[model samples]
Target: MDAFFASVEQLDHPEYRGKPLAVGGNRERGVVAAASYEARKFGVRSAMPSRLAAQKCPNLIFVPPRFDRYKEISRVIRKIFLEFTDLVEPLSLDEAFLDVTNNHFAFPYATQIAKAIRHRIFLETGLTASAGISYNKFLAKVASDLNKPNGQAVIPPEKAEAFLEKLPIEKFFGIGKVTAEKMKALGIHCGRDLKAYSLVFLTRRFGKSGRHYYDIVRGIHESEVKPDRIRKSLGVENTFEKDLLTSSSVAETLTNKILPEFFRRLQQSQTAGRTLTLKIKYNDFTVHTRSRTFPEAIPPGSMEALALELIRQEELSGPVRLLGISLSNLIRPDDPGRQLRFSY
Candidate 1:
């Protein structure tokens, strides 16, 4: 999907069409969850602060997120994908990777499968989609972004190496802003530059991920797309309009706002975990975390108690800006004694 959340909003609200629009933020506070192409022209982007977005595109319209509606549309899109191949690995509500090696339509070419899927999605959902067809996941993911809204790109195996060699290090998937900067500092500016380093050298420089960098530059990603990707953790976090100035205020916010939302998501996922983590972001944009793990899935009432305990243990370094609660070390359905027993 293209500008998924913002596109959906435009689909439902015709007045927003062709206008710079954003979803999930207000002019005064919050962050831009998605930005339409019109908004992007003015340097507006997803995850940008709403205030900065407004300053970038003064005419940008902000709309609250309707996740239920987005999910409904996502389900419809997934159904379309299943029509082509059962081997669909969803990255999020709006993006997925489909292994069409043996598709339901008996299509010999993955490109054909991509075109069919994109067409079906547009027909069923009235939205545009982009696709990247390639021999492997890494090249496919990178190819997917080469074209813009309603376009598709492909990188055959023969051309993968040359394409990767010229590609900027920053454009590679899994290389974030910080990692890209680190690579640049090491005189690694492109895939070709990265490929010049030995496996041992890369591993020494980048730790475990150095091997990944070495392999991907030479078009050597062998990881298969797993359709049933298990979620590792579930969390909820909130940024306050005003910084929380005291521990008492932080506790009050947790009691009244954060904890309820976290538990609601945990229940909705129908899963539990043994570890509870508390994440804090201070006004200076620095972050810290504390966690506790139990012998079994955390019991009812324990998450709240543990979260508060974690908060109390950490002396506030500065006025707090955000707080998050997460559960990890999940109790999977196949795990023995998976049933969660609640106790006060």
Candidate 2:
């Protein structure tokens, strides 16, 4: 899927087509959930501040998200993916990893399956999707974005080493801003530079993740694509148009606005957890989180009380940018005894 949320909006509302648009909080302090290709040309991007996006593109149209519609469409896309292979691992509503090694279609090449999937998605959903075909998840993920909307890129085993050598460290999966800066300081700016470090040296510097970095740099990711992945947490967060300036305002929003939606999702999923985490992002972009793990599942009405307590514990340094709550250590309604694995 390309510009998934924004594309869906455009498909449903013809007026938004070929125009700079974003789907998310349409406020000065809100964050963009997704940006259309037209918006991307003006330096707008997902997770960017709405105010900054407006500054970049004065005519930018901000539309509230329709998650239910997106989810419905995502299910349609998933159906198309399953037609090819059962070993499909969805990373999000829009993106997934498919192991076409033993596809049901019996395609001669993975690239053929990729093409067919993309074609079927467009035919069924009236939206475009870009695909990447590779031997491993990391390369496939990176290659997927090399081309734009309705395109596909493939990295064969023979070309993997050369492909990685020229790739920038920042573009590699799992490398973030802080890690990229650290790598740059150590003169590790590209895949070739990353490959220069021994496994022991990388582990010494980056802890458990260092080994992962080393393996990916040499095009050796061995993780399997597991299907029917379990969701570890259920959360809902909101960004205000105006920063919440007082403790009272923050608490009120959490109780009156966020909690209802949160509970609705929990009920819909029929999942609950003993651990509740509170997330706060300040206007300055600094974030802090606090969590409490109870011995039992969070009972009805207790979540709000616990959330309020968590809020009281944190010292608000400035006007708050975002407020969210997540419940982890989840157990399904039908099987409360079985605990789901928590993933960060």
For all candidates in order, the CA lDDT equals 0.91, 0.90
Q: Weakest 10 consecutive residues, lDDT, candidate 2?
A: 335-344
Compared with the true structure, what per-residue lDDT tens digits does model 2 show for residues 1-344?
99999999999999999999999867575889999999999999998988899999999999999989999999999988898899999999999999988889789998888888888888899999999889899999999999978899989899999999899999998899899999999999999999999999999999999999989988999999999677799999988777899999999999999999998887777777889999999989999998999887777467889999999996799999889999998776567465433221
Best by TM-score: 1
Off by over 4 Å in 2: 332-344
Error of 1 at 202 (Å): 1.0
1-344 per-residue lDDT for model 1 (tens digits): 89999999999999999999999768987789999999999999998989999999999999999999999999999999998889999999999988899999898888888888899999999999999989889999999999979999999999999999999999999999999999999999999999899999999988999989999999999989899999899899988888899999999999899988887877777788989999999977789999999888887576788889999996899999889989999988677767854433
Model 1 C-alpha RMSD vs. true structure (Å) is 1.5
Name the runs in model 1 displaced over 4 angstroms: 341-344
Candidate 2, residue 52: how far the Cα is off, in Å: 1.4
Cα lDDT of model 1 overall?
A: 0.91
